[model samples]
Target: MEQDVSAFLGRLAREVRPRSNQWAGLLMQRMRGELPELWEDEDLARVALSETVDHVTAFLDGLEHNRDVTRAELPPAALELARRFAEGGVPISTLLRAYRLGHVTLLELLQEEAARLTDDRQLTNDAILRLIATAFAYVDHGSEQVVTAYQEVRGRRMQRRLFLANEASRRIGTTLDTARTARELAEVGVDHFADLVTVDLLESLLRDGGPQPPTDAPLLRRIAQRSALDGSPDSPVGTGRSHTYPAESAPAEALATGRPTLLRVTTPDAPAPSTPDAPAPPAPPGPPDFGIHSVLLLPLHARGATLGLAQFARDRTASPFDDEDLLLAQEIAARAAVYIDNARRYTHEHTTALTLQRSLLPQGPVDQFAVETASRYLPSGSRAGVGGDWYDVISLSGARVALVVGDVVGRGLHAAATMGRLRTAVRAFADLDLMPDELLTHLDDVVIRLQKEEAREGAEISATCLYAVYDPATRLCSLASAGHVPPTVATPSAGSRAVDLPDLPIGPPLGLGGLPFETAQWELPEGSLLALHTDGLIQDRARDVGASLTLLSDTLAHASRSAMTPDEACERLLTRLLPERRVDDVALLVARTRALDPSHVATLHLPSDPAAVSGARRFTTETLTAWGLDELSFATELMVSELVTNAIRYGKPPVHLRLIFESTLTCEVFDTNSTAPHLRRARTFDEGGRGLLLVAQLAERWGTRHGREGKVIWAEQALAQPHLP
Candidate 1:
């Protein structure tokens, strides 16, 4: 039976040779009509079906009579069809189903040809059995080959995706800009993953504190969008465009459910019937040629919250987005979301710290009676953030001014708080009329105490300060440094010089130990400039401190020193020396020296006898008359009598009295006693206590200033503008 069947198959091959082309065409027609996926891809489907039919017909034509099995080897074309399916992101199940359906068509044709040739049941049955055996053998071989090709191509595609994942992980999130991070997410998709990309962030996240919209209609603002198409990048709804999603919108659903979505975008010119279940169409995405076919909306979820959604789109020229592409888009969005959240948190903190620093600083133009001054304070860049640089102009007794510039050890709120504590202490100490060196000595104690407290909490503290006292009476500037840079002093006679100050005997920085601090006194003349600043004004990591100081001196020397007010000098110095963005905090205070003219002063040396009180009062009354201050003489005489009597009767010897005529009438009595006077209520029975009490009431301000040898009891009465003759 096998021999007869083989002979019959060989006869059948010869007889069917004329009509083999017709049989293959018929099979192709059948598959196209039945399989819709194959028909949609007309080019690949026609080529693949044509090749399969040609091979099947050739196998029958080449059948042998003596062979036990008919040979029908799988064609290389079958492997190519598998590759094409994989490239189009089509499933392999359809490829196998098509081959099975084609096998049935081939078998049906074999039976019909056999019946037309012989009309004998036995011969037809044997031909059918041999044909079925050979067909199954071919189908099995081709199916195996196609699967191998499919998997090989699929593997390469997955490898490429892996490379892209690594590329996105390495490139995105390199900066702290939240918008840049979103733009980078869009950038990653263009030309590589999709033809067009857009990133939509939660509007609530970008807006300052506010209540959110409903869950189904949460707002999303498109932060970034890019396109490979020539005109698509100019799309209006990108990079800061906002849109409110309807209840069934894709973005809303994806965010509300915390899941990624793959969807079909409606065509540009398509008409829509009103369907309540339909998602509202998003705003027009600009140019009509953008041709969006498929969209993948992936939620950017991190830290238990959905930050935003990333949308990737492909035009009609490319295949629709698939599950694998959606997965990749989600992965990329996930990476960028983490970086944006971090940037958002940092921005919140930085803004809060900046606000706190500004509030803690001094405000308004500060005018001490003895000096007119101006100052500038600049904060560092975002990288360095906020630091503790502060300056103050403090008014002291005897027409002295305390110029303070200090820098705390760190940045942010903690450093600013430390600066506040030190500034408060400096002002309190200045009121006591301590010398420059003594004020810093007391400030060092406060710093050490603060450091101890900070250290117990596992934090270290250190600081540098320049404290200077300028006495208009003597035209002297007393300066002390706690590891601070020397201030710049400019004069018409001397030119500009960075004062070479000696370091305090104390350890460097304020918090180290109790050490003796050295005070340097410069006999600054009228029109002299004393520039006190934090080290940030003169020091940076890239430049040498000496070089910076020399540059500062030269800049000041070359500037028009005589014409410059403290404000002009400060503005010019900063414009010439500092860049737009500073790396460290800067605090600069400039004071132009104004000495008390000799003509405005009247001095008298008195014998310490009890009779010197009347002479002191007479001297004050005559001096006030000569300076055209007669209107102030009554109050002035009363203050002089009380102060000089106290200085001679109970105070030390070598008493001298002086009256100064400037903005106010100043009367001072000097003695060798260092004890500060106390104001007290005079009892009904008390006699002499009322003298000091009466002085306090007659003078606008009264205070005691102690020198090394003695103390001066001074009173200032507001002057009436003189009637010039």
Candidate 2:
């Protein structure tokens, strides 16, 4: 049976073929008779049907080729089968099976025919050609059967390729943002012989150069290249045949007319000859000979500027690109132009902001004042915005110094103006050496005056300011605050503390109507440092300002061990305090305790006793000797002796005396006397009346203070130390 079937298949190869419709009828009849009992798998049955049809079509194609060659004879049934197979939709898989079985030579003959069909020339000797290698797969190339199959498989592959190409283009666009050179951009269009040049005029060249840029002539600039026939060049780019791109060929004309242009150029140089014996030099590089006819140039535009253009050569193997592709390129160029401009503007603004901000800050140290200062102002990372916070270190007479930092209410120029006004006033007052409360009250008046001129709400200009006067000689800090953070004292032995303020805000902010601002004072001990700042240090609306202060205190506490000087400690704390997204400005000032030799100042903490008085007087005398104030020590000893004796006799316990043995001896006695102790007239006969009179006579200056806990009686005597020249 197999031999008979094979002979029949051989005869069928030499017959005429029918169309697919009649072949379908014959296959259905054959399926019913040969495979009725095996009809369980509907899916498998469909597969068999498709396979059978493929083989039948291959057999019919073979039969036609045989008729042309051998004029072979065919029996009636074989002839009918060949005709039916052609009309049927046969599967290639089944035809391949039949070829392997040696039933026919159809596969070989059809393959030969397909090979001859390779060259598709719609026109012969056509002088002009325009082809697109990519377009051929889409519209014109391949047979009906092959084209259909390609639509199913190759079409999907093309879709995926196009998607990836679009994504890559987007990424390339991102990479080209702000790119200024043609070479840099050419790396993006790696496969093309492309140059990005600036277009200044419709008929002229531009001095500046770039791939995508702004141009005044939005309609006339163009980009162009040589055709496949002409070939690009044998230069570093391997695209062989070389052609000249005349300045005239620039699509400036087409763009000026609101149209696009496509042209082709032929190169003067021919492919170099190769030797028969030697390995041929690489075929002079050139565009692949796919029968390209012309080059296409498209104009780019954005923001009413011509910008530049894109040029590409058509493929010789395919139809030339048409209006659709040109439109796509134009769209791509438009998007690219906008991106370049935005990037440039952003860079310019960023640089400008930094410059303006630095200009508004204070730069140098003031003389006579030992000041340690630092400031940190961070702008929001967002585009086009800034804030205002500033600081000052001012110098004054008598070895006095002032620290000032304040934050204006809002942002931008208004806030900056407010900051400048407030700082200037503080510096002027600092020169006056006004006490803290007096200075703040004066500042309030200035703010009120400025508010009247600006016509803005005084409430809107609200700010916090802390002023401290540091006297290096006395190691005393007379401080006052106006709605600002209080100064903190960090002692070598006592750690850190916020110095207590006994009064309400040194009167309600300067512009607000309020009376009587009181100044606060503290005996800033030797080895004690003070920290002052604005509300920006501790206040945030999201978290309580108090909590921020706690955090600050903790940071300052930890910083004490590692930092070497007041400046170093302030820097450490500032770095931690200004984290990202800081909503306000920060100013910090640190003043270390003025160094004093132990011999110059004698400290006396004595009980209110006649013996204690005597002890303090002896300490004064001995301290004077050490400080070389011996001559003055005699006067100091007598004055201190009398004060201690009076406090022991009728004054209170817990007397304190500090003998500052500088150019003079200052005898300060702190006693529990509520009464303001006085120096009365002493007649020649009254020895007790003469005690204080003797004190007044011996010292340069003497005073008494009625403090909260007790009264302090103090006197100063000239020192014996040699004067500085």
Candidate 3:
């Protein structure tokens, strides 16, 4: 029976071998009818046909030799076809079904051939049974090999998708800038998955504290877009420009429903409906022909709110998106949406904080006779948000001006509020004509109290401050620091250098009590440039403080070479010393020193006796008339007499009087008395208590500043314009 079966199989192979092409064609036609997805790609279809022919030829050869079907090797073409199916996104089940259908068709054809070759009923039955057993074994072996190949390719594709998704997640949202984040998302999509990608946020969402757009037809601003094609033409609506999607467009539908929509372009004219039977939505507005074939429109939904829309597109050269691609795109969009939303929130907060900071800061240029001043303030970058850096120019008494620059420890709204409080406190302290060290000491107390108040909310506060007072009358600048960078001074003879304070030690930063701040005085010549800045100007992650300070000094020296105004010097320093990426806020205050002209000043010594009061009054009256300020004689004499009489009566001896002519007429009484006089309301019967009170009332502004050996009681009366004779 075995010999008979072998003989029948040999005859069957002889008849079937020449018709292998015909049989392969038949099998392909069957596959095309039942498993149409496998034929979507023309290249894959050709591969399938060639693989079918090879399989039929191999089967016939094995039958002719009567080989063991179980030991037969799978045709390379068959394995290649299976891999193509996987790569082409055709399902594995479809490939297996094709194999089963081929096996059944081949078996039926072999049986008919066996019967035609054998006339004996017993021989035909035996041959049919042998063919059935051997064909089944051969088909089983081939199916296993093809399935293995399919799985290997599928596994690699999955890994690639997974790696692309992870790379997108790692690279996106590295910065808190909305535009940057959007660009990152676009680049990731174009590099890994899509031929083109675009990110469009609602116009209102980008505005600070703006209301959400209406859902019917939302207006979107294209923040970022990218394409795989080099030198791609600009989109119809460029980045930063706004456009509205058609009401029934895929993007609008996706946003309205908060669901992703996958569209396949069946023709060049328009995008096909998401579902085959459903009506097509309106085409999205864009350039006439981008050759886009597949589009995935994902709403940027996060935290239960839809913020914007992200679109991923594949051109004609790329394969159409499948269910698996949809899944991956959703994941990428989901991750990107979270970061975009975070960036949006950060943008709002940063704008608000910066606005608050700028409003609280000084608005215009400071006009002072002691110095020509200009200032600049910059908030931190998006990642760090706005910080608590501040600068101010406070006009003090005695032709003096106070320059202040300070930095709170942290960032955001709380730090900005803290900065406002400290600045106000500094101005208030400055009004009293307190020394630089004394003003900082008072500011330190305010910060300590603020910390105590904020401690209940689990927030700790600390800050660094630099305070300097420039007196035009003495050409002396007294400066103090509270853990802050020292100011730099550029003199006519000497180059720029940081003010070195050997005797005055730097005190602890504010919020730490019990540290005494000491003052250091430098005699700045006329036309000297003084620069005061927050540490952000000279400190960064890439360089040390020493190097940054050197750069600052060099820049200042370069500016000092020319007759650069304070404003020009400020611009030069910022251009030279500021880093590309700033993590902290920067505050720069520049001032050019001016000495009070000797001809504008009048000075005299007074004897410590009652007779000297009349002489002092006469000297002031004569000086006011000489300076063309005769109208101020009466008020000036009254103020000078009261201040000098108090100094000689209740204060120490060696009284002196000086008159300064400037924006205002200043009368100062310097006595070797450390006791500061207080302004008091006189009683109805009081005679001597009204001296200081009268001085305060008559002068535009008055204050007393105590020095090491004496105190200065000064009053400024506004200079009235002289009438034309």
Q: Point to the candidate with the largest TM-score.
A: 3
lDDT (Cα, tens digit) per residue for candidate 3, span 186-208: 99888758888889888778764
Output the lDDT of residue 286, model 2. Answer: 49
Ordering by lDDT: 3, 1, 2
Q: What digit string (tens of lDDT, one per residue) describes model 2 on residues 1-725?
A: 43433333333333324433345334544554544533233543454445445545544543333222122222233322322222222333432232232222223332333334334333211100111121122112212333344245534544644653474355534532244322222333323322211211222223233223322323222222223234434222122211222223344344444345655434523222222233325324445553333444555455665544445444442333334434544454455546544544444444454445556666655433334444444454444344456667675433346776665566555666677778878877765546677778888888777777777544366666777766555666666666666766666555554434344344455566465666676656555656666665665556786777777766665554344577676776677665555555556666665544555555678875577766887787777677666767677788888888877777787777776543335677777876665778867786577788888888766766444577767775544453421
The per-prediction tally of clashing pairs is 0, 28, 0
TM-score of each model, in listed order: 0.80, 0.43, 0.81
Each prediction's whole-model lDDT (CA): 0.76, 0.50, 0.83
lDDT of 2 at 136: 25
For this target, which candidate reaches the highest lDDT against the unseen true structure?
A: 3
Worst 10 residues of 2 by lDDT: 124-133
Decoy 2 TM-score against native: 0.43
Q: Whole-model lDDT, candidate 2?
A: 0.50
Q: Residue 463 CA error for candidate 2 (Å)?
A: 4.3
